[model samples]
Target chain A: MQKGGELVERTETRLNPGYGRWTPFWFLAPAVFALLVIGIYPTISALVTSFRRYNITRPRDGFPFIGFENYINVLSDQTFWQSLGLTARFYVTVLPFQLFFGICIALLLHRPGLGMLRALARISLVVPLATTYAVVGLIGRLIFNRDFGVANQFLNAIGIGGMDWLGSPTGAFIAIAVMDIWQWTPFCALIFLAGLSMVPVEIEEAARLETSSKTALLRYVQLPYLLPGLTAMLILRSADILKLFDMVFVMTRGGPGAATDLVSIYIQRVGFRVFDMGMASAQAILLLIMTIVLSRLYIRLIYKEIE
Target chain B: MSTTLRRVLHGAGLIAVLCFTLFPFYWMVSSSFKDQSDLLASPPVWFFTPTFANYADIFADEKVFGSIVNSLIVATLTTALSVLLGAPAAYALARFEFRGKSDLWFWFISNRMISPIVLALPVYLLAVQLKMLDTYLVLVLIYLTFNLPIVVWICTDQFRSIPIELEQAARLDGADQFTIFRKIYVPLGLPGIAVSAIFSFIFSWNELLYALVLTRRSVQTAPVMATSFMSGYELPWGKIMATGTVIVLPVTIFALLVSRHMVRGLTMGATK
Candidate 1:
């Protein structure tokens, strides 16, 4: 038994210095260290803060821990409920249009013999991404203005009256959705183009040369190749749209009447504007949970076939 | 005729998209030239007499030039820190074999997944605790949380794409790991680094939320400066548009110049 123990120890020592070494930790420490302090710790702290009533105004009194009361209030609050509905509306309106426009443009540019047009299209698509969201909001603001704006000018040119896009609830929601589609369609298109470029040309050519069945080619040949990338882009875009804040904050501040308030925008107003840290933390925790849950579910549903 | 129909439709689609994208930017520049009353006209003005009063106001009242300088410094610092931190990390990942590697990688990227607004409150508290609010370091750290991952991700892609035999050949010549990276990999990967740096700086410069939450009037950046009038009693569309133009012009030019590289960098690994 003693000889067996000695042999085991000797084997472990030799192996540790060789194949299954501790080297990855050295490469990983700085990134993991920063992320822990900045990303992970803050999230855990936010979760803990949600259970306590923390008002900076009364720092002298200090925080009083009240377990789950904040969560109860947040879940039951009418304004919180409205923001939830508004966020859903945003996701519904913007995501489909984003996917459609993105896929359309990706397919359009996936052809041959349109060099200059394709180049111009590619550059134009990504310019919005380079612009800051606040500036983007303002750009959308100037264009969507009901009066003395280009949208109205175009409406007049088409023999139609311009509606107040940011002045009413439905109109404001539409305006915010429009802003989202404008900002992110390029991102979607780019991802799809990346995926499109990777599609096997011989398979496509085989379909074109050997068979003239467009539907069969699309339904089988192309879709399967593009599914993984489309899944990734969709999950990312969905999560991002749910957390949309900067543009809405700059454009409407949850606007004409809480119409454009996304989940993050709701948290920002509650936390920053009203100075209700407890309630805000509750909202933040909720949004965080919803985002994680939805993203995981989406990834699971879309990628299940691969697994 | 079928092909002709396709060409005309494609042409129209191209025009529509260009108009959709550039019209807003054009109006921003055009609106800066319009007078206050002209801006408020019932229908929007397509062609108008141009002026530079709005631009004059931004430079004069808001001290737009100073904010631009502030923006430049913060962005440069943030980009530099991310690259400095990220390059070493990327090198470690590309060359080493270690434990919990993938988990560590995914953890680094959780910053990108988790919303910044989630960290806004705690980061605000951490900044005050460290007495680092409104300092360049604060901006660097906050931007680093998100930007470092990008650098690591982009650089890792670039590093991995380089053939391993070259590194082996250098090693056989008695070159150490650090020397090999510096002498060979760094020069080869310089363009990728440039792309990554530009992107990090652009993201850092264009960020408004953290700057809005952390900084005050004295150390305010461009994005925060642009928001000055929205809180005022009266709206100043012309002056606002002027600031808007100034903020976007640099990024617009930068984006067009680096479009090809940006495409490659952003779409990294997605195709593969």
Candidate 2:
């Protein structure tokens, strides 16, 4: 029986020898075709549309080829630069708050034997993470509504006067950032928690024998182990931040003098509100280039550290 | 620090984190049950008889009900289609040694890096030209860009993790390639497939930008309808809160069900 089984196995394996060369190709074809139509084709079309004056509102004009005009126009446009600047500021400001809180929460919940507290924290954290961005925006609007909003109401209860959150430029910008931080800090925390859990117990125990201070142990041992997770969090957050749109759209709508106009919102406005497809495509291409380049740089840095 | 002091500090930090993470959801649910007068009350009425009027108002509207259905259909169909197409490709990449395999792998992973804005205009124009705007099919097709990469990434990792001995044993039993994939790989890869499905569902459900621009009147999803409440006159704080509650409830419940898998799901393909 064993010999017969071995003979059958060998023959069966030989029946599909050499990785079944044609099978994988057939298996991969549907996905490749889907990506081509949905991803690659549209991207190339966007590139083509950027060089033409294709305004949806102007059906009579037709999509005449306008070489470099849209790109040059976007380069000189003040709103474009302002939006880019705001995107950078939003990313820089919110990231540190999220990371700090994330690390703190991760450390607190990373204890090995604390079953109940860790479970509670994990459940609570998923609330903000799972809440849709649009809902977050709506909640922000409610909390920041100047007249009866809870934020101002809380301040007034403490004898501080109510401040206009959405009506003012800086308040609106800060409110948007706060909303982002609230929604995403949990994500960072959870990722950090996962990273922290991977730190071997023996390594920590050895460090504890040598060091008396918790901070020293963390700084020397745990942080180095968490470097990869930190890099992953940074890359993921930075990419998403660059493309942020929903909160700004729902809460501020780039209002009170374009205070919270992130690049995504600006591009959407250029395309849909202004019906300037050419300019929007140009701006989008630039945004895409920036996103890809920055992500590549981050990946390179992380890869070096990994080695 | 003394152990007592350390314990106190840790408890305090945990409480603060919990409150920060959960307060918004509390406020949303509470406000959803508040009357319009109670909703806008200064000093924010903490004690009040909760009302279902807001929920009643939103459910009474046909547009809102239609949007809820639209969101369900789009998210469901997108999840199914992405897994169907993406899992096979992931299996191929995981098991086969082909020319340019590494390059293909890199391309599949890097596809996640592309911003939706770059695809928005071209897709919108294409939809317009093809007369496919305001249709469920278009949203499902476009959502593939986001969902497929994740499916491929996670499913590939999943297939790779399964031992090759199982497949060899199946082959020894005289099973062919298709039978091995169906009877062996699919059943074994269920956990990973479930994770990928949850991811695709959450993404398609939470997606706003594509839905916002792609559909207008006939096919608006819940998120798009939720945004509509913000734009019009007399910002109906009651109905808006109610809508927010309804939109968040399903996803929150789903997340809690799979809370244990949250970290593993998010970090699956990225960590290694």
Q: Proportion of native contacts in model 2?
A: 0.74
Off by over 4 Å in 2: A1-18, A112-114, A298-307
Summarize candidate 2's per-residue lDDT along B131-214 as a digit string, tens digits.
Answer: 999999999999999889889888888899998768777765788777877887789998888888888888789889999999
CAPRI quality band, candidate 2: medium
lDDT of 2 at A156: 87
Top model number, lDDT: 2
* Backbone clashes in model 1, listed as residue pairs: A24-B98
Model 2 Cα lDDT, one tens digit per residue, A209-267: 99898799789888887788787777877788777888778999888889998889889
Q: Can you write out model 1's per-residue Cα lDDT over A33-149, one digit (the tens) per residue?
A: 776776778788888888988877778878899999999999899988988887777777788887888877877777665689878988888688788888878877778888766
TM-score of chain B of each: 0.93, 0.95
All models, DockQ values? 0.46, 0.66
Please give the lDDT score at residue A125 for candidate 2: 93
Q: Give the residue spans of candidate 1 off by over 4 A.
A: A1-24, A210-216, A294-307, B261-268
C-alpha displacement of A294 in model 1, angstroms? 5.4
